[model samples]
Structures are given as structure tokens and as C-alpha cells.
Target: MLTIVNDFLWGQILIVALVGAGLLFTIGSGGVQFRYFGRMFSVLRRGFHHEQGHISSFQALVVSVAGRVGSGNIAGVAVAITLGGPGAVFWMWVIGLMGMATSFFECSLAQLFKRYQPDGTYRGGPAYYLTHGIGQRGLAIIYSVLLLVTFGLGFNAVQSYVVATSLQASFGVATWVTGLVMVLGLAVVIFGGIRRIAVVSELIVPLMALMYLCAALLVIGMNITAVPAVLGHIVQSAFGLEQAVGGGLGVVIMQGVKRGLFSNEAGLGSAPNVAAVAHVPHPVNQGIVQAFSVFIDTIIMCTCTAVIILLSDVYQPGASDVDGVVLTQTAMAGHLGSWGAGFVSVALVLFAFSSIMYNYYLGDNSLSFFSDENPLVANIFRVLVLALVFWGSLQDLSTVFGFAELTMGLLAVVNLFGLVWMYRIGVRLLRDYDGQLRSGKETPRLRTEDWTDLDIDERAWRD
Candidate 1:
């Protein structure tokens, strides 16, 4: 039943909605993602500078990246290849490209409608935007609930299961032991609140991503001669020119879209929860940074995993036994010997741990939408999240992934509809930033007065 619903959602509904909204956002934003590609790096440099009590743009970005570059980059990529062939990788790239624009719009709107908290932080996401931007409190509640289920419960479980399985495969550790250890470690940071989550993600995300990329580079260099052929195979398989897998083009496209969205979460409404927390000069600046994160997550990190797997001789087109993180680990071990598996296990632990922290923060944020930051409610929510983490570690891969995908698909549907409905507001925010830039402002600050007609919290943008 779970698989049936996920297949329909990913195949029929989400594929069209995801692609269509991405294309629409791309056109509506006047190709902002491309036009400001270089500007993204510049903005990121400034991101290191932020108000003392608030989160830096860089910290927010890394937290969001932590959430994105998790099991999806490793296990999910392997699954895509196993089920849809090399052609799925091509479609993943396509979604990454299109998702950049969608990310820009959604993240910008998040910043635009973010609320200023008394604790000297900001809070917002699709829920805040749906309520404050469009006056849709009911829709906001629905989005918050979906977000809570998808990230807080669903994705965290998936992450825990991936990490637990990876450890078991590499170190021969019992899954239950790994689950207990993970639960204890997660409880430490999550209990410390969002600032601690930001600090941990900041320190871990860059280091882990860099190390993983270096390992992937070594593997690609070892198989440099075969690189061109592999690239050609992906393209050919994508178009059904090469029958590498029996599923054909539809399956190839579906797998890529699903895995790609899972990896980067560009338009899935997940990243915006952290994107709203950044103290940037303009909302679009954070949006640009978030857009670059999608690039990093998919184009850089996920491609590294895909290339590593495709380059390894262990990866057969239809290998059912070796799938998920095990496939990735086997491919790594084949490339660099036994120690390679250990390296992948360590990397996955870091990746999935940070993702769990990120997932917790998103869930906590959503809980606030209902409980208004009540300590009892927050603590109860945290306990539930930890319980799910433990439960997920004991579950099989199919169970965790299926549940996460279904809930994720539903979350995306609501957020995408809200994004499309509130498209003009996103555009206006972009134009405001663009106009300031054109006027030669070094860093364009959002003046809330310009948006007096909207329900924006002026305190968030106060000078």
C-alpha cells in the first residue's frame, strides 16, 4: 500500500508538479539562478557576517545542506541506479538544474515572511508564508503538520536506518546497538536547541562533504579512461537509446526525479525552514545562497556518489542484492579495498547524523506552529523524534524509504501549490533586491516599509 501510493505520487502527480513549478519559477524569476550564479558566491562570503544574536547565513546554509546531503546522496542514488539504470542519473541532473530556480523563489519567500522571535532568532517556512503572506492559516496548519511528519518523523527514520545499516555492513555491529548510540548522541544536541544544531552542522557538514568529495575524486581519477563512456551511457540510457535497464524512459525519469528531489530538497519546502533563519541583508540573498546549496548537494555531492558507484566494477545494471548504502559501500570497497567500506560507514554516519539534527530542528519549528514554543510540548516532540530514530534503525530499507517518500510527496504538493499561488510576492521580493542592486547598493537590505501591504513582521527587518 505504501509503495502503491508513493509510485502514483512520484510518477503521476509529483513529477509534473515538480517540473512544472520549477520551470514556472525559472521563467518568472527571469532566470535569476543563472543570472546571479556568481553573485551567489559573493553573497556567501558576506554570509559569514551576521548580527550577534542571530544565525549567520553560512550557518543556516550548512544546516540546510546537512538536511539535504544525507542518505539520498548515498543510498538513494544507489537505489535510483539499481532500479532505473544509469539514465536515472541524467534526470537527477536535470532536476538539480531546474530546482535551483524553484529553490530561489521558495527560500526568498520564506525570508520575506519570517517572524522575529523574542529569543533573538527568526522562524518561518511554508507555514509562515502561507499564513502571513497569503492569509491562509488553515493551509499553514496543514503544511506544518505535513512537515512535522515528513522531516521530523519520516526522513529522520530513513536517515537512522541508513546509518545503522551502513555501520552493520562495515563494522559488523548490531543494528540495535547503533540505534541506541545514535539516539543518545542526537538527544544531546537536539536538547541544546537550534543554535547548537547550527554550530554542530557548521563544523561537521563542510568537513564531511569535503572528505567524501576527495574520496570520490580519487576513484574517478583511477577510472579516468572510462569516464567518457559512462557519461555517454547515462545520456543514452536516459533517452532509451541504450536498453541498460528494462524499465524504459518513464521509470528512468521517475527514479531520477524522486532521488534528485530527495537529495537536494530544492523545491520540497524543507530547506526554507533554515533559510528563514539566516540574517541576510536581503531575502533574495539568502535565496541565492540556498540555490547554491542545491547545486552543491546534487551537482557536486550526489554526482560524486553516482560517479563512484558507476566507476566501480561491483555495480551491475540489475543487481538486486546490493542496493542502497550497501551498494555504495561495496562499490567503494571494490575501488580502494576493505578500508574503503569503513570510510563510507564513517562518512554516512556523519552525513546522517547531521541530517537527523536538521530534521529535528525542522520538526521543532513546525511544532512551534501549533504549541507556540511551549517547553512541555517541545520536549514531548523531541522524545517522539528520538523514539522514531530508534524504531527506524530496526526497520528494513523498504519500510523507511516508502513511508518517507509518501509523506514527502504530500508535503511537496501542499508547498508547491502555495508557492505557485504566492508567486507574485516572491517576484516582488526579487525585484526589490534586484532594483537595489541595480542602484549600486553593495548589499541590499530589505526595508519592510516597502511591503506595508503584506503581513511581514517588520521587526525581522529592522535596521
Candidate 2:
């Protein structure tokens, strides 16, 4: 019964809504993700103009990328390949491309409706916009509660569990040992609050991502002769034309979309929570940055993992026992001998650890909605998240994953509906941003007066 419910939520309902909304945003924004792809790096290079003690646009991008580039990029991609075959990889690319638009609109909206905290930090997400932008407190509260469970407890546990299992598999380490180390590390970063989290993420995310990508490229370089054929297999298999596996087109697309969501988190409403933290002069600036993050997470990081697994001789589709992170570990080992498993174990630790901190920030930001400026609320939630991280390391995989999927599905539905309802605002913001650029402005800063009717925190946008 539980499995059926989760499948319905993730495989059926959420997929349609997620993809449909993404398409809608893509058409609505006139391909903002494509038109301004180059401008994203320019805006990032312009650097941060944040308030005292607040994070810059790049820091927020790093924090968001930290969350997006986690176990999902490694384990989740493996799962997609195992279930959906090489074709699944092609669909993953499609989702990544479309999701860029979804990410842009939602993140820009997050910035538009973000609330300023007393300590000069910013907090916002689907909940803030649902309440202030759509004027529905009930919907906002539900969104917050769902986010609290999905990221704070469920997703964090999943991260810890993946790291623990990978370590146990690769190095004969106990799950409890990994849990203890994870708890200690999580405490130091999460307790220091968002700025500390942002700082650490900025440092670790880039270094770790570069290291993992370099390793993947090394493997791919060695198998350069097989690259073109493997790429062809991915496309053919996606349409049920390849005969290696029997998941059919439906299963292929489902696995690709599901794993893609897990990796990039474009329309899921999670990334926007951190995207709202950046003190960019204009909301679309961070929107573009967040959109670029989707590219990095899915197109670059997840694709790297996909290539690693697909290029390996060890990959066996439809092998029920060899799936998930173990499959990825095996593939890496096939490429680099026994040391590959150890390398992946270390990579998972870094990937999952940064994600746990990023998850805490989302939960902490949600806590602000229910109990404004209340330290106790955030403190209690912090304890709960940490406790779950420890407990998840020891819990069964099915339980943790199922719980995560259920909550995340609900969170996506709520957030996607809000995005669809207020998508015009996204279009309007993009137009406003593009207008400034076309008028010869180098760096476009938003004026609160431009969006007079919206419930924007004027102080946030005021120059």
C-alpha cells in the first residue's frame, strides 16, 4: 500500500505536473534560460552586493548547488540507468534542459517575495510567496510543514543513509561511525547559521565537484573510443528502440524524470529557498544563477556519473541486486581498480554532508514562517534534523526513501501550483530585467517602485 501511494505520487502525478509546468514556464518566459545563458556568468562575475553579514549571489548559488549536487547525482543517476537503461540518460538531459526555465521563474519569484530577517538575513521560498504573493496563509502553512518534513527530516536521513551504506560497502566501516562523524560535521556548520553554511558550501562545493568531474573525465578519456557509440545508445534506448532492457518508454521517461528531479531540483521549490538568500540587485540575477545550477547538477554532475556507469563493463541493466550507489561504486572500481570504491565513498561523504547542511537551511528558513524570529523554534528543529541524520544511517533504505519521496512529492505539488498561478509575475520580471539590459545598462538593479502592487520587501531591493 505504501509503495503504491509513493509510486502514484512520484511516478504519475508529480511527473506530469512537474514537466507540464516546466514546459509552460519555458514557453511563458520566451526561453529566458536560453536567451540569457551567457549573462548568468556575467552577473556572477559582477560579484555580490549583499547587506552586512549576508551572502552574495555566488554564495547562494554555491549553497543551492551543494544541495542539488548530492547523492542524487551519484546514486540517483545509477538508479535511473539500472531501471530505464541508456535511454533514461537521454530523458535526464531533456528534463535538465526544460527544468532550467522552471528554476528561473520560481527562484526569481522567491527573490521577489522574500522577507528580511531582523539580523539582516533573508528568508523565503514557496511558502512566503504562497502567503504574501497569492494571499493564502493556509496554503503557505501547509507548504512550510511539508518542506520541514521533506528536507529537514526525510531528505537529510536519506543523505546520511547513502553515505553510511557507501562507506560500509567500500571500506568495511560501520554505519554508526559514519553517522557520528556526520553529526559532528553537521553541528559545526548548521549551528553557525546560514552565512556559515553559505561560506562552507562556497568552499567545499566547487572543490568537490571539480574533483569528482575530473575523475569522471579521466575515466571517459580512457574510454574515448566508446563515447560516440554510448551516446547513440542513450538516445535510441530512450525511445524503446534499443533492445538491451525492457522497461518500455513509460518506465524510461519516469525513471529519467524522477532521478532528474532528485538531481537538479529545478521545479521542486527547494533551490529557491537558498536562491532567495542572495543579495543580488535584481531578483532575476539570482534566478539565472539558480538556473545555471540546474545545468551544473544535472547536465554536468549527473551526466558525469551516468557516463561513468554506462562506459563501464561492470554495468548490468536489470540486475536487481546491483543498483544505486553500489552500482556506481562498482563502475568506478571497474575503471580504477579497488581504489575507485574508496574514492566514491569519500565523494559521497562530501556530497551528502554539504547537502545535509543545505537541507537544514531550507528547514530553518521554513521555521521562520511559523514562528517569526523565534530562536527556540529553529533550535528545536535543528536538534531534530541532527537526530534524524544519525537515525537514518542505521534505518532501512526502503523506509527512508519512501518517506522522502512521499513528502517531496507533496511539496512539489504545492509549490508547482503556486508557480503556475503566479507565472505571469515571472514573465513580467524577466521582461523588466531584459528591458534594462537592452537599454544599455551593464548591471540591472531592481526598483521596488516597478513592482508596486506586489508585497515585496522594498528594503531588500532598494539601492
Candidate 3:
């Protein structure tokens, strides 16, 4: 079963889908992420502004980041290092740089195509962009179904399992206990819709990320001298030039690309769900914000984790394997002792909890993508998500984590296709946006092909 599952995940289709689409997006937009790297920080530091959409840009970014900066940054990186080797970190950096452009393109299209719903809110995503940009109803349906399957079931289950397992180990609690707490919390936030999700994410994601980053920083600072050797090992191992603490170059590259992309999810189409709700003059404004989000997730948050592990130097030249949250805990223990373990446990709880809540919202949107929402189906999916939490807790690492990663990769393929289909729209939007940037105009309306043709009077927008 594991072989079949792993094979199913590692097959040609997913590889082509993820790699091809990613490369295509990078080339399509002239490597926009690379060009815009330095500018991303200026955009974020400017903070949220008042616009005409449902939420502020920062809130939208926060909600999206809530999903991206997940346990994958911590445990996921460990998994990458375990399989792909130290050089995988370099691949991750490649993914982060390229994925930002993909993210920018897709999210810009989402904002461009979004519908102002009858309830004075917004609704859109890969489904909307695929339908609106490509005029492929069938494509939208297929993408929505895949997103629902992957986000609602596969990723949700993985997140719950991580939470439950960590809690059981740390606090000696029942797995079900953690699942229920997550389920109830998720239900409450999601029921309020995008606005509520935005507010909650903005408040919680920053607080949790800051606390965790601060702790990791202190540990890294204490052992700052080891940084050079650690980096040297990463470089040497990446080229197969030397044997560092990690294992395989191919696997590491794949792992870094995998986790880095997973962490920020720029091209994966997940962030656009929240992006569609933001009120901004130009779609690129949100795109800029999303780019900043990638920096925060990988360049800042994941780097902190990596640095701490390196600084601690917990792994001996020949020690039994320790990966995932355990590896992180082990590294921290080298510095803070038992307190390090406790810290990661607490971090996992918050990280997984925030992530699960965001995933639930994604599932909810995905459910709505079917046209009509069914209370029965929604409730059932929620229950299954919670049940999978227990299932994840009980399963062994190889089986459960591999299964989850496979599902995530598959689902990401679906989302990436939808985004890739909308590339033309993004280009045109950016063209107009670039014009405005050059002109320095106070009236910063986006460039549109046919402003009057917009679905402006969309129910709540009944002009």
C-alpha cells in the first residue's frame, strides 16, 4: 500500500504538472519574482490601505499566510532534509524565488476576476479565474473538485494529525481531544465567512509567528559561530561535493523545492481565495503583498527553524535519525534542554491550529465552488476532517506523511493549472499597473480591457 501510494505520488504526471507549470509561469512573466524581490519589502512595510474590496490588503495577506506558514515550515523542512539532503535548501530557495512570480500572476488574475457577491462580500479563486479568464466551465468544475478533495481531506487530515500527535506526546491527551478543539475552533471562524477569517488570521498569525521566530532567534544567536560551518555543509552537500549531515542531492533539491513551494504556495492558487476578497486599486498591489508573504514564510520563518537546528548541532556524526517536529525539538533541546521540546510543542499547537482553520476555510470555499452549499455535506466533511485527525495520529510517519504529501502535490497540480490558464490576464493587468507606476498618478485605477464589461452589478453590486 505504501509503495503504491508513494508511486502514485511520485509519478510523471505530478512532476510534469508541478515543474512544467512552475517553469512556464516563471518564463511567461519574464521572471517577475526575481525582478520584484527588493520591492516586496517596501510594499509590505507600507502596510494596509483603504480600498473598495471586502478586506484590507494586510488582512488578506495574513489570512493567506495563515495557510502558507504552516507546520510544513518546521516539520516539512525536516522531512525535506531527511529525504533530499542538505542541498535541498538551495532548491527550496529556487522554488521560493520562482514561485513568487507564479503567485503574483495567479493572485492578480483572481483579484481581477473576482465577483462582489450579493451579500456585500467577495467570491473567487482558481475556479473563478479559470471560468472567467479561459471561459472553461468544465475546467473550473474539475479544479474545484480536486481542490476540495486535497484541501478538505488530505491536507486537513495531515494538519490535525500533527496537532493531535504533538499534543498526545507533550500533554498526554487523547487525540480526539485535540481534534475536537480544532474542529470547534475552525467551525466558529469559518462560519463567519471571509471577513471573520481575515480578522482572526491577522490577529493570530502575526502573534504566533513572532513568538516562534523570537525563540528561534535567541537559540541561533547563542551559537552564531557555527553558522559558517553549517552553510559550508549545505553548499558542499548540495553539489554532492561533500557528505554533510543530510543524505541525497536529488531528494534534497526536490525536498527544498517541495517544502519551499509548500510553505509560501505562491503558484498553488490557495492564496488567491483570500486575495479575491481584498479591496485594492490594482491587482498587483495584492500581488506585491503576497510576494512579501513568501519572504516571511521561507526567508524569515523557515530560515529561523533551519538556523536553530544548525546552531544547536544536536545530530552527531553518527546518530539515530530524528526528523519532523522531533528533529526540531531535538535541536532546541541542545540549547534550551527540556524547555526547547516544550517550546516546539507549543509552536506546533498554534501553527497547526491556525493552519487547520485556514484549510477549513479553503474547504468551505471549495464546497461552495460546486454552486450550492449543502449543510449536510459541509458538516460531514468537517467530521471526516476531525476523524482523519485521529487516523493521522495513529498512523506511522512514512505512511501518513507520504500520503498527505502526495495528496497535497496532486491538489497543487490542479490549482496550478487553473492559475496558468489565467496568465494572459495577469500580464495585461501588470502592463497597466506598470504604466501607473511609471506615471506616478494619484488616481491609481487598474488597467482594464473593457471597464464597462466588468461584472460590476453582480447581485450586491446591482447598479
TM-score of each: 0.97, 0.97, 0.88
RMSD of each: 1.5, 1.3, 3.2
lDDT of 1 by residue, 1-463 (tens): 8888888998889889999998998899898889999999988888888788888999999999998888788888999999899999999999998899999999999999999998889999999999998899998898888888888888888788878887887789999999999999999999999888998899999999999999998998999999899888889889988766777788888889888987888778999999999898789998999999999998898888888888888788777764677888889999999989899999999999999999999999999999987999999989999998999899976776678678788889989989999999988888998899899998898887788999989889886
Residue pairs clashing in model 3 are 53-279, 84-251, 84-252, 88-252, 103-266, 118-460
Name the best candidate (by TM-score).
2
**Each prediction's whole-model lDDT (CA):** 0.89, 0.88, 0.72
Candidate 2 or 1, higher TM-score: 2
The global Cα lDDT (0 to 1) of model 2 is 0.88
Candidate 3 regions exceeding 4 Å error are 1-17, 45-47, 50-53, 245-248, 316-322, 373-404, 447-463
lDDT score for candidate 1 against the true structure:
0.89
- Cα deviation of 263, candidate 1, in Å: 1.5
In TM-score terms, candidate 1 sits at 0.97
lDDT of 2 by residue, 55-155 (tens): 99999999999999988888889988888888888899999989999999999999999988778888888999898898988998998898888887788
User: What are the per-residue Cα lDDT tens digits for candidate 3 across 261-336?
Assistant: 7677766677887777777666787787787777788878877777776666664432457467888888887888
